[model samples]
Structures are given as structure tokens and as C-alpha cells.
Target: MSNVIIIGSGAGGGAAAWRLTSKGLKVQILEAGPSFDPLTDYKQDNSDWETPFPVKEGSQGGYIVAPLQPLTEETQDIRSWSFMNGKYVPGAFRTSFGYHHVRGFGGSSLHFTGEAHRLNPKSMSLQSDYGVGADWPFKYEDLEYYWRIAEKISGVCGPSTEQRSPKNDRVLGTPHPISYASQALAAGARKLGLTVTENSLAVNSTPQDDRADCNYCGGCLRGCQRGDKGSIDVTYLRRAMQTGNLTVTSSTEVLKIITNANRITGVLAAVDGVLKVIEADLVILSAGSIFSPQILLNSESVHSPEGLCNDSDQVGKNLMETLLATSTALHPDKLGSHRGLPVDWISWDFNDPISIPNVIGGCRFSPSMAESDVVGPIAYATRIVDGWGKDHKRNMQEAFGRILSISGIGESLPNSKTFVDLASETNSHGLPLPRINSYIDEMATDRLRFMMTTCRNILAAAGCAAPIEEFSSIDAFSSTHIFGTCRMGNVTEECVVNSYGQSFRWPNLYIADASVFPSSGGGESPGLTVQALAIRSADHILRNKGVQ
Candidate 1:
């Protein structure tokens, strides 16, 4: 049998490994971080007060609070807290964007919110329909079946009757019960001529894949201890390992992709401070948008001095950092924000490709509970409350169950100016760190403004008493949906990989992550799409290479 090495065990790598191994191919997965088991690592039944909050080391050696404050107990897990977390060299638009990703056995999938949304067909054909962004090498119809398979594998649940796109035919599992926050948003959306639909989530509603149903603990980001959330680690990766054809090596960092002529021969990796070479006929780079390209760039050789698949210098050029806009308002009625999933509803009114102008994407608005515990007191003491003592206490009491929030997740287009390159600095393993340079363009700014306005109106219609408050611009820390460093296209000059995610320069190397996305769909979560594409890539590999 032909041996395959898949780097990173997130949604993309896990899905690809599952598909390949199920077909009898031997697969080896190398993860840069330690293995994370939610059963043991997750803090079950622990409140924010019980968990130890993250504290960064000060320059003077004392401990200080981390800049990115997490109000949940999951932050207690180092694996979940460091999800997509990496260092970057400062460049143009450095201040505008920040990179946040998790590194571990499951990658960012371990800590994701589990929203599985399919891209609108129009978004797949961006150039033909919207006259912006590069069109996908293949249409959505080609991957529709894979999307269905991905949803099935992940056990996605959503409203069966609510149709967001005509192209989406995959039947979701049992729908989650509508929360008060969702109901309030839906009522407000209806008044404003918008439609609010049940979000397709990977979290279980009625129990599938041997996982328990969601208990509505509102602690999804903290890592689900009950296995209700369908992170690839608990789902596809577990299944793949059970097949006996898959082997996972955790805490092993791939330093370089060893190449012979134009074919990938093996990977040079550092495992527990020891360097070793693992042989493989095929290599799938699913190390995510940032590190995936970094690996390729670091794999320079005599035959490929620029990089393994950089004949056209398209390996790490176009980067799309998903834009996020948020709004907060105080509702007059008590909308229990601590009861259900962190994000329980979605509004697709702005996702329409044809109806909106300069709006090629959509946004999702959900109730926010970020300031629930210690942070809540801090928020009232600093900003929300007008006065001290009784005023602060009264404001806290009034806004406890009355505050509602919305986030507008907007689609971002590829810009040549934004990209990931090799930084002068190197990691502990001596591999160069990824230098990210990105900035929000006018189109993204306009879309964010529109989404913020729309979200404010929705909150107003939902009976919010206070004026909507818009928070800061989208940054790397706030935005986790990173796409398009190694984009796929019909031609190698314009993209890094082909439609099957195979590099034109090196046929044995494939990519199966958001890095292969030609265009970021209008506000749709990339988790499902990444898994779908990974499944398709596995099929392509099987068809072309066949079982040895």
C-alpha cells in the first residue's frame, strides 16, 4: 500500500486521513502540538471562577493578564487556548490584522464554534457573478455531494425547512431548539425584512455518532467534555485511527518537505528534540493557511529553490483574513444569554449575492456572553456603569440578563498585498516563522459598516432599549477564519494547487485546508467547506494513484 503523510489533524487533515484510510491507504498524521483529549483535558462542570485564567509573563518576570481575554473555562486548557496561536513578523497592515489559530492534535477544530455552513453557489463562481475575487477552479455542484458527506460525518443539525441557498440540498440532522436570543433576533429580523434561520451546527441536538446531545451549557469554546460538539479529533480522526491504517504522531513539528526531482520523497521533522525523516509517497499539507505555506517555503532545494510549489510564486500570495464586525445592545426584556450555545442563530438576509451592492458576503449575529463572570464586573466598573458602588451594581443587575450582542461575519476577498512569507526569526525548532502582512480594503470596510448597521437594526427591532454599540475593527485576534494563502485555481500561475488540491510543480503534494479556497464565501464558516474539500482531495488521490 502507498503510504501517505498528512500534516496537521484539524478538520481538513482529519477528513482527508479518514477518507484515504477508509479506502485502505496507509496514512500517517503529524501534529505540531501535543495530543488533546476532551474527555481528560476539558474542564467539565467548572465555572469561570474555578478555572485559572491565562496570565502572560511580564517583562519584569511578574505575571500579568493576557491581552486576549477569554471569559470561559476552556481557556484553562493550554491546547484550546493556543488554538491557531502563533507569532508573526510585523509588516504592512500589521496593526490592522492579528493571527489567531490553535495548534494541537485537532488544530483549530478543537476550539471552533462548530458552525458548518456551505458556500453559496454564486460565491463559488465569484468572477462570473460578482465581478470580484477569483472564481473557484470547480463549481459548487462538483463538491455538493462531498458537502453532504461532510455534514453527515460531522452530524450537523439545523432546521430542515429553512433553505438558505438553492444549491444546498444536504439534509441536516435534528434541529436545535430555538433559544430566546434566537427568537428575539428572528422577531427583529422579520420586522426589518430579513430572515433568521437555524444555524447548521456540528454540535449534536439529538445525539449521533455515539455523542451525547448538547446540554446548552454555553461553554462550547471551552472544549465540550460531553462530545456533543463534533470536533474532528472526536469524530473523523478517531474513526480514521480505528481503521488501523492511520497513525498519529503528536508534538512532531514538520521542519521541511524533502523532495527528489519534482516529487515529494519524505518529510524532515523534529520529534521530541530529535530530527528524523519519515518516508511517504504522497504528502498532504493541511497545516493551515499560515504554517502550510511556511512549510512549503522552507522546503527549498536544488530543483526548487524558490519553494516546493512556487514555480509561479503563488504558494503564499493571496491571503484572505475573514472580516468580523460586532455590535452590542441592552434588551429591555430578559434574554437568557447563558443558557444555549454561544452562537445559536444566523441571519442570511445580507448574504444574497445579487440583491446587495459591494456585498458579496454575509454576516452571522449571535448573543454575546463574553463579559459573564469576572469580566462582567470589570466591564461595569470601567465602562457600562455610569457611576460607582450602587450605580455599578444596579447597572450590572439590570444588564445581567438584558444584554444582547450580534456579530457580522463578512466575506473577505484575496488581495495580493496581503500574504504570509518567511520571517527573519525562527522557532525553537529552527524553522522560520510565518511573516503575515494583511490589511482590510475598502470593500471589506464597507461590508463591515453595512453589517454593523444591519445588526444594530436587528437588535433595535428585537426590543433593545439602549443604542447599539459598535466595537473595534476586525483583527487577527478576533478573526479566526483565515483563508487563501495557498489558493487553488485552474492555472498554476494564479494559484498554488489545481482543482484537486495537487500542486502543479509537485504532483505528489496536495493541500486540503482553507489555504486551497479560491474565494472566501460570503460569511459562511469554512469548517464544513474545508472538510468537504479534503474529502474530495482524498478521492482524487485515490482515483489517480490507486491502491498499491
Candidate 2:
């Protein structure tokens, strides 16, 4: 039996595995998807210039082909393209909200935009400070060291600590070069009295951690071909593998957690085609917010008839997602919109400030098309530009580098109405599909409207001609940052896991993912927090359990 069995090889699982292996623990990771090596698997030669305006494949508006079978007959839906995509399972749900996640060795890290930002201290203590959302059991100071450790391991690049908010001050690397479009946006935001700063990214600006420096290819979303992006496969997982104490089993799906009385004994999984039982002294579920709850809820036994480690019945409640709004502006002169990293600039001045009325959480502003190619540009132009034929082609050509977009990523509070539960139907794997129901409350809607207005004003201030408002409200399917399904708290009545990510019902079982987040921190990306918390969880396990 392995010392620890980690389910999922994403940011959380990878980080925990790395830390545990470094501490001389034997770790086994089971991944539901195939292994991905960026060096060989990344499509470097495929450029959007070759095929402009390709047919939309998914509900999230992405064109890149994923390496998985198409949706099963039972899951097909034209309106809900998420079900048709290989990346996600099509479970029946009532709300427009869906998840954008990848099932692979590196998990969603493979397609992350690389924007890495820390949550404000105030955001961490939301309930204590603002009377909304659950307060994190631990303070930000407790995780600051782990955050720095995560930054070093991921090779994150960002502005100096002094330049950023005092709430987040531990810097590990230098920031990437700002694009012309970002500079213009920053200048425009400054005119509107909003502070714009360089965004911290997982992509390398200078060669470090044995990874090559970013060459400014502007294809971060498709996958970083040059090894500059810090996906888990290349960073934590690679290091963990090198330690010789870790074994990663890809293309293996975990069906349920096997429990012996009150303790978790192992995991029952489908390896290749046959069912296999892998025993472990400890089990860490990092299958993400949507699937982690699904696995736990499926693990029914005589000792725990409801589910393993779900005595509180809080395993799949409080599903939270980032509320996003986007606006496009046509610059009078070409500003080279599609250059450098996708999200080079970020402004947090408007995010959940105490003075802003009806604002319970913050919002972040970033350049929307830094990583876009010709196809993306053309598709976006079709929405903003007029008529077809020669005029359309001419306008598209002219708008390629002249148009720029700014997006607002806002924080949403976890409400009782939004949650993840078992659907009536079963998936291809013969397991109950996850049913997600998410709704934007009046306060969240008002926050989105305010964020959109701020984006428009910034674009206009940036000297853009006729800044057009494109989209608003939370795109339930578009958010890659999902959290709060299996939250951490001091009491079992409110949370599934404790502050250290250990299950209250089953002590040996831990959760190292966004699912453990008690409150979704501000508008910043949750990648950094996920990794930091995982590292912290690993430390807790080592300190309590010791080397087996």
C-alpha cells in the first residue's frame, strides 16, 4: 500500500504529491485522463492564421481539439456544447452554469491562461469583515509562506512586492514585458483613477526551473509549446516523479473511496478496462470541485450510508464560480492587441472596495485577447463589425490589431441555491452524473453591471474610438475558476473538511483542491491559492501522520 493515494494530478494534487514525496513519503496519483507532455503534444505549428473563423466546438467558445472521445449519445446537447466536448461530461442540469475543466494528467492547468494572483487578506476573512460568505478558518498570514513556496515552484513572474497591494507582498520572480495594448489600457485606467498593475503569471519571462523562457508566441490557451508556461505536468508533477517516491497512473478513473469502518482504506478505480482496488494509508481527493464531491457522494457503505466523509451532508453544496463580464473597444490606431501573454495587465482598484455600494466582492480588469490568434480575432470581429462580403473582410482585416478587449473577473459569494448534486441519469462510466445549479443573485448582478461600466469607461479613457459593450453577467460555463463545493471550516456542521483540508468524519482522508475553499477569494485566479493550500495540507499530513 502506498503512503498516500492522490486522486487527480492537477495543481492541487501535483503540489501535494511533490511536497509529500520530498518529505520521503510514497505517493501514488490516479488520473482519469491520458498523460500529456507539452514538448511533444502541444500543437506548435497550428496557427489560427491557417483557418480563420472555424466552427465553434464547445459552449465556452474554444476551437482547440482535445484528445478524448466525443460526448456519448446520452450526453449530447447542441445548445449545451459543454456536453459535446471531450473535456467535460454532459450531466443534466437546470441552470445555464456549467464547468470548464480538463480531464488530463495536468488537469485544467493544461489550458489555464497562466494568470496567477493572490487573494486580498480582507477577502480571506469575508464573513468577519463584510458579514457575507464564510470566513476561512485560518488567516492569510498562516498560508503566506506556502504561497511563496508555490510561487517559487511554479516559476511565477510578477511585479515587485512593493508595487502590488500590501495584502499580497511575497514576490518570487520578475514580471513579463507589458504589451502595447496593455500599456494603452493601463494608461486609460490611470486616467479613470484606477490603479493598473502587471499581472502575475505562471509563464516564465526569464529561463528558470529548467524551463525555457517565454518567446511571446501568444498561444498560451492552446498550450505552451516552448515549456515557458508552468503547467503541473512540467512543474510539480515532474519534480515529484524525479523524487522516485511518486507513481502517477494516468488514464485511470477512480470510482469510489473504499472505507473500512470510519477510516478510508483505499480507492476502487478502473485502470485500463478492469476494476482494481489500490490500497493506501492516506487518500487525498483533488479531483476538483465538481468531481471530488461526486466521488465522495458515491462512496456509500454500511458504516456511512449517505457517503464516505459526508456525515455533515456538506460535500456538494455551496458551488461558487467567478462572475465574468467583457467589453471590446476599437482603437483609432492599431495597438498590437494580440501580442505577449493573454492577460498582461490587471487592475484591482475596483475589486470589493469598502466604499463601493452593493459590492460584496472585488473585480479584476485584464486584456482579453493577448493570446488570441487570427481565428479568434475574426470571430470577435463578426460580433462587433457590420455586414458581410467585401466590407466584412475589409473590416476584419482592419480590425485585427486595432480592436482590444477588457474583461472583468468578479468574485461571487457561495449561496445555498447554487450547488452540485447527483443527476438522475448516469454517465458512460456507469456513475451518477453531477448536476450543477448556479444562479446570480441581485447583488452579484449589480456587481457585474458596475464592473462592465468600469471596463467601458477605461476603454474610452484609453483613447479608443467608440468602445462597444460586448458581454455582461456571469458566464456559467466559461469560468475556469470553480470553488466552494466542499468547503473547510472549524465545525463539521458547516464544512466537509477542516482548515487543514482533513475530512472531519474520516481523519486520513484529505482534499487538496478548490473544493476545500471556504470562500472564493476576490477576482484573482484561484490557481495560486489551490497550490498553496495543497502544500499546506501536505505539511499538515506529514506533521500529524509522520512517515509510514
lDDT winner: 2
Tens digit per residue, CA lDDT, model 1, 1-548: 24899999998999999999999999999887776566556665544422322221210111111122222232111111111122221222223334555677677777777889888777777777768778898876788899889999998998765455664455888878877765876788789987667788999998789889999876667677788999998889989988999999887888899988868999998886689998889999998888899899999999899987888988778878767655566777767654677677787766655545655655555544441221234443444445568766777777665657676777788766678888777777766777776655667666766766776777888888644344434323345788998989887688899999998878899999999898887788899999999999999999997553
Instruction: Estimate, for each residue in 1-548, the C-alpha lDDT of model 2 and write its tens digit.
Output: 78999999999999999999998999999988776555555655665432421222111211111122222343221112111122222343323433567777778888787877777777887888879889999877888889889989999998766333455466667888888777888888899888777788999888999999998767777777788899888999989999999998877888899988868999999887579999989999999988898888888889888887778888888888767767677788877776778888888776653535767887778888642232255455544566778988887777777777788888788887778887766755677866766666767767777777777788899888765435443332445788988999998898999999999978999999999988776688888899999999999998896554
lDDT of candidate model 2 versus the reference: 0.76
Give the Cα lDDT of each candidate. Answer: 0.73, 0.76
How accurate locally is residue 534 in candidate 2, as Cα lDDT from 0 to 100? 97
TM-scores of all candidate predictions against the true structure: 0.88, 0.89
Error of 1 at 454 (Å): 1.0
Off by over 4 Å in 2: 48-97, 162-169, 352-355, 370-386, 467-469, 474-477
lDDT of model 1 at position 287: 88
